[model samples]
Target chain A: MLKNLLLNRNLTCLFFILIISSFEKIHAQNAQVINFNSLQKIYSNKSDTTYFIHFFASWCLPCLNELPDFVSFSDQHKNEKVKMIFVSLDMKKDSIKTLPQLIEKFKINVPVFLLDETNADKWINMVDKKWSGSIPATLILNNEKKYKKFFSESMSLQTLNKLVK
Target chain B: MIKNIFDFSLLVAICVLSLGFSIKGNKSSYDFHLKNVGGNFVSLKDYPSAKGFIIVFTCNHCPFAKLYPERLNGLNSKYKNLGVPLIAICSSDTITYAEDSFLKMIEKAKNENFNFPYLCDGEQLAAKNFGAQKTPHAFILWKEKNNWTIKYSGAIDDNGAEPDKVQHHYVSDAVDELLKSKKVSIPETKSIGCQIHFRK
Candidate 1:
């Protein structure tokens, strides 16, 4: 009986270890590092999905201030055809730990990605030749990849709604 | 066939993406008369001796701006004698971010032991005229017959987060070329930094 109990406890510990690691893996995969070209393909492809991509950084105060509104907006429109992505332009170094913390801090369920690019000159113009490389910028795209708009500053839920429509 | 199709689609997507907005670039530099941290007014035209100006839109609370204090100090002390003094601007709305108030700016200047004036853009006059969107956004201006013409505008260097690891020197090289009476080689560069907290 004693031996059986000990084996059961060991199995339970192994099970938890597996679950925790898999959870971490899923979360890691969710925040997959992407560049401008890769992301252009995903949102600009031809389907019926509306793409709302918001650029933010952990260090940006304005980005932090208006994030909850964006998150709640996304939550409220969960069933809609709109797909929201929160792109964290945070430096690639600390984002592994910091991104998770910020997500947990706000209890955000929206998918967040880290824009993994170093050469700003090449990629900045690619996104929108006119983007002055400002944070809290946003991009909304339609299925045909024709109806697209870029906001170069912090926006509210009302602004977000109007853009989606 | 796939290559042609891919290229054609990308062109269409880019045309659609870049339709509405025009990215701000080189233009005539704007003149300003704003108060420094010391409560005195200063204007760009006052520096008659300077061959040009390094008007950098910066503030106290920005991490990117904070990293450049030593660099700014060096730029001023080294080039002030060369007739290219650096003028830093804080365009952040003080009402929204109390840490960026004039009082704190003075404290920050004192703590940093600044050699140059750090002015407060009380009304965001300079920021708007120059179309400056980010803190630590640098513009290298060279004087023409009378007016100062903007020659280069963008980041200070290739890297804003790390200094020692920087490979390209954008502002310094431009300044050096201007001092030598030669046209700047690479006119512009870009980097990530804090957006200016302008009030709606």
Candidate 2:
């Protein structure tokens, strides 16, 4: 009886560990890191892929609230040659703590990036003149050749679908 | 001589009428006010000693605003003494996000040691008047003769994320030009920051 109880406890521990490990693995598969240089290269090389760049900050409640829609949209359209990039506008200091947690919590299925540029104005203009440095802003590009549209509001999947299509 | 005088008066009347029309059109920028962090009311008229007022629509929760807290503080400190008083307004809806409430605003101001008066636009009337769509939106008001005019409106600097990378300091440069009795070259630029949270 004693031996059986000990064996049962050991099995339960193993089961919990396996569940946690699988969860971690699944999360790791969902999020990929992309830097500015990598992004430029991807856009230049894969001209067929539609790029959706999202400007967000961890501190922004609207951005946080809208993240799930973005993740679901990315998952639903994985085979459509569409790519989603989450560009966090979080300060450089908060990147390590906030960025990964946000990516995990939102179950983001896309490349995540931190805007490492120092000057806010220069980078903002570089992205688009109409951006106005607003969080939860999205820039949709068609095949890296066309400037599709820019939205300075929380996005819905319907809107994303329309833009991509 | 009487006919010449009458003609000159007619020309002056036409010019005056056109100027009045333009000022009325531009009244939107001047028609707003915000409650200061101290819960005291303040408006463009409150700064009687100022040649102009720098109205910055900013918030505590925006990373962009957090990044430039010191730069803004410095601008306020330097310019306030020189006759251009800075007024920082928070138009974000604090009812939903409790972190942006008036209390948090006080904490942010105290923690940042802000030299300027941080104001709260509780009803967002001021934001609506200016059509402010984003946090960190700026409007530089200049007093011309007795009327207040908008000299510059938009981003504070060319650098959004990195202060060190700034190519142009729009607010400071405009104030400097105004001090020199010259016109601001760039009157407007695109503003970037968190979207102003309007209450439903």
Q: In terms of TM-score, which candidate is strongest? A: 1
- Cα DockQ of the candidate 1 complex: 0.33
Tens digits of per-residue lDDT, candidate 2, B1-200, equal 99999999999999999999997786554645666777777777777778888889888877677777888888888998899988888888888657789989999989988888888888987787777778788888888878877788888887766678788999999999998999898888875577888887
* lDDT tens digits, residue span A1-165, model 1: 999999999999999999999987766665778887888787877877888888888888889999988998898789998889888887787788788888878777877788887657667776676788888888888867578788888899888877777
Error of 1 at B140 (Å): 1.3
Q: What residue pairs clash in candidate 1, if any at all?
A: A130-B23
Task: Quantify all predictions' global Cα lDDT against the true fold.
Answer: 0.83, 0.78
Cα shift from native, residue B90, model 1 (Å): 1.0
lDDT of 1 by residue, B1-200 (tens): 99999999999989776763333322244778899887788988788788888888998877778878988898889888888999999998888778889999999999999888999997886898887888889998888888788899998877666778777778999999888889999887666778776677
TM-score of chain A of 2: 0.73
Model 1 residue A72 distance off true place after TM-score fit, in angstroms: 2.8
